[model samples]
Target: MLKDLSPQAFFMGLLTAFVGFASSFAVVLQGLKGVGASDAQAASGLMALSISMGLCAIVLSFSTRLPVSIAWSTPGAALLVSAGAAVGGFNAAVGAFIVCAILIVIAGLFKPLGRAVAAIPAPLANAMLAGVLVGLCYAPVKAVSFNPAFGLPIVLAWLVVGAWKRLYAVPAALIAFAGVLAFGVDIPEGAFASWAQSLGPTVLLVKPEFHLASIVSIGLPLFIVTMASQNIPGIAVLKVNQYEPNPGPLFATTGLFSLFSAPFGGHAVNLAAITAAMCAGEDAHPDPARRYWAAVIAGIGYVVFGLLAGAVTGFVALAPPVLIQAVAGLALVGAFSGSAFAALKEPETREAAAVTFIVTASGVTFAGISGAFWGLLAGGLAMGLARVARR
Candidate 1:
């Protein structure tokens, strides 16, 4: 096992954790807030997610012997931004999250439900994930335009390191981004000290309130997106890399963890898409069998990061939100490119995939449901029509 501990895999794992968290962690916070979580609840949510997903990653990786990295459902969080507000308030949102979690657990345990989700055409799944990421990929460009002095240099660092060592590009960009935050950003007085005072993990329970409207309007849609957009694609990502692990427990694990964390401000935890590639891809380890360690180390990194999340949240408050988004975009370019390729690769599903891509990327929401769900809806309709015409 120790022989597998190469610097390449270790650093790549670290990079995976850093990029994964930095990318859209702000969205997690925003979604929690939109759902009506108090500032304290939001901090608690972040901490719980880091710990929950961390343990999940460690458990799945060791048990399956595959590089299975779990993540908060970013798209699910995106749903919360609009749905949380629409459905009522934060407590209502917590109720919706609980319902969604129960549904995810059900989907995982039932063989027919798992098969149905797995049956989502590969092209459409890839396209939906690509669409979700493409919008995020633009953050660095926006960052540069918004703050060239900082963003431009980070881009240069990423490009240079990417050219030199492809695996390290995102990590280098992250390091540069962190340096800028460390030295350049104006952190408010006593932010660190105040955060330090509350260094220990705190779980804030929002006793879930069940409402029928919320269950249909918020919970069902949230489950669909998490399963379709995050978990399904996450499995696809690992499969394409030639790592096939049982999906049942993987889904069940994340669902249960999401359920556990919902009261504490965490939104949803599912299989990771972009960052999973970082740990499972060739860059993580030349020998695919050894790549699981990358994920295990990533779990460790998450645990440490979660412990320090209180301080990080304080700094996040002190900094410009856009910059954080920009850094996240930089981290995700590789994943974006990979998903795009997979989405466009097959001719049979090409048109349907394009529909999925466009609808998801458009960020259109309806009836408190996100574009991801609609993207699948639109793409599925188009795909079904195409199949009928062919038949």
Candidate 2:
């Protein structure tokens, strides 16, 4: 099956899968902790994410014949960890998931809000995206501080590949991984060995209880963040690539998936920007008809990894923290730059976008929600009010 694919298509798919796998490791760990999951449960959550996103990617790819890679909702995952830690534990988190699903279904059904989000000015939407990505860059930079030995090599790999203009199209991450191996970095002896030891998995089938508090705290916030931060920009990415998937179904499907998987500790699911970009690019498949296989491969990878959640967690834990951080930051550089440029491009929107960028990057939380959502809301409102006054 792989042999018929062009070299670019094959490599793009491979790169998308690798990035999708690595990017979610830390956030998954946080999700497990939110629900007070044991080591095994925590690992299972990671596996669940891998499986859900992987399967989604595969189905969407093959069906659409586009390089549409699905990924665990990064914002949703981060929110889950943060909110789940604060609220009534896993039960509350589950409540949030249900609420998010309801909201998504409504959005799909309503038509107006879905269209509004899709219709947001491209510059403004991109500005909001840049604001959202501000913090993501820190992960890799911080990773360097945590484990310089491992982190340094990864950074060097990015630099080397970046400097070598000839290999510009080669995945910087693949190069980074090779650099890490070349450095002869010591892998913990027990890291690989632990795969053989099975901790009798305890699966908690959470019966989601509806609580007003949980709904307000988790559900409402998750819906907002997922929509504002993840889904909106996701649609933008698709549009940017000229794929133009129907936003209603796409949003509805992701929400439905999250609703079903929340009890199993799966965070939000949405379209993947960076990974999707890999397959959507001209380099991936010029013909466009063949690019979808990359996503199919990704979805298959997710399901396989999710079943082995324990092993996935162990593997992540075993890797040097710096390495994880470095890889994350490097991977997000393009996103960060894109966001910043978007935020500053328009003379009229600059101030509001700047405010959004600052507030979001500050990482402040109020009323049980993170700064990203609030930042965008506040900035957008400010811009709106200013326009009204001038008019």
Candidate 3:
């Protein structure tokens, strides 16, 4: 392992961790808060997720000698945002998180279960994810409306940098957001004291509260999105790069970490889709076998960032909510585009997919269930009827 270490691998590893964390943490924070977490609880959740995913990545890379990157479920967080507060609030959400983690573990251990998730119509799954993202995707424009002086620069930074180098665009937006917060936004008197107090990291162990509504609304959708958008794609990326580590154990390992973190208020952790490409690609190292070192280093980097979760969360907390949301929106544009394209690509399923997308994006709630579950249900019905008509 020592012999495999190289400067290129180290740099790529650090870059991957930095990009992965900086780009979408606001989404995570917002998701936690959306599900009724207090500021302290949200910070704890963020810290728990960061540390769990980081350790999962490290253990997997070292054990399998494959660049298996783990990350918090960004799409799952987006699902929470759409779901709003759970019927029973944060504790209920935490219970749902645990249930999702257990399901992930079961999927890994049981072949049929994993296959069942994979068997969900691709169009419906993609459409559902696309719908979940709609509200957040509108944040940039809304931010501009709220305060052009504060929001325009962030959008411009993302656009200009994205045009030149797509990967760094969100980070650029994040930096611009920081600039706006520091200079443009008004700080309430005594905010400095609060910010200072928040700098020290804290973790709270939340007791899980099981509620059928939360399980249906948040848990089930979170599990599906994490599997479809993150875990499955992550494995595909590794395979495309010619590394074929067994997926079952890797999924199980991440699920275990998710379970461990749930009591600390974290949502699901799963295989990283985007950053996995960075660690598995040739850019990490010319030799494929040694690329695992990059993932290991990236894991280390994530752990370091996890330690600073308090400060990061505190700083962002002081910013205007729209500004922070603008950054989150910029971070997810790529995901939204990809999921939307995938959902609509197949002519046969296009109508059903559209139904799913519309329903999910509507952000409707009925009988204590979020639209995500209903969207999938409606799309499935639409698809079934379409098939029957053809028959």
- Top of the candidates by lDDT: 3
Whole-model lDDT, model 2: 0.64
Indicate whether candidate 2 or candidate 3 has the larger TM-score.
3
Q: What residue pairs clash in candidate 1, if any at all?
A: 35-90
| lDDT of each residue in 133-152, candidate 1, tens digit only | 77667878988888887788
Name the candidate that leads on TM-score: 3
Ranking of models by TM-score: 3, 1, 2
Per-candidate TM equals 0.80, 0.77, 0.99
Instruction: Tell me the tens digit of each residue's lDDT in model 3 across 4-120.
Output: 999988999999999999998999999999999988898899999999999999999999999998889999999998899998889999999999999999999998999999999
RMSD of each: 3.9, 4.5, 0.7
10 residues in a row with least lDDT, candidate 1: 78-87
Alpha carbon lDDT at 250, candidate 3: 89
Model 3: which residue pairs collide? none
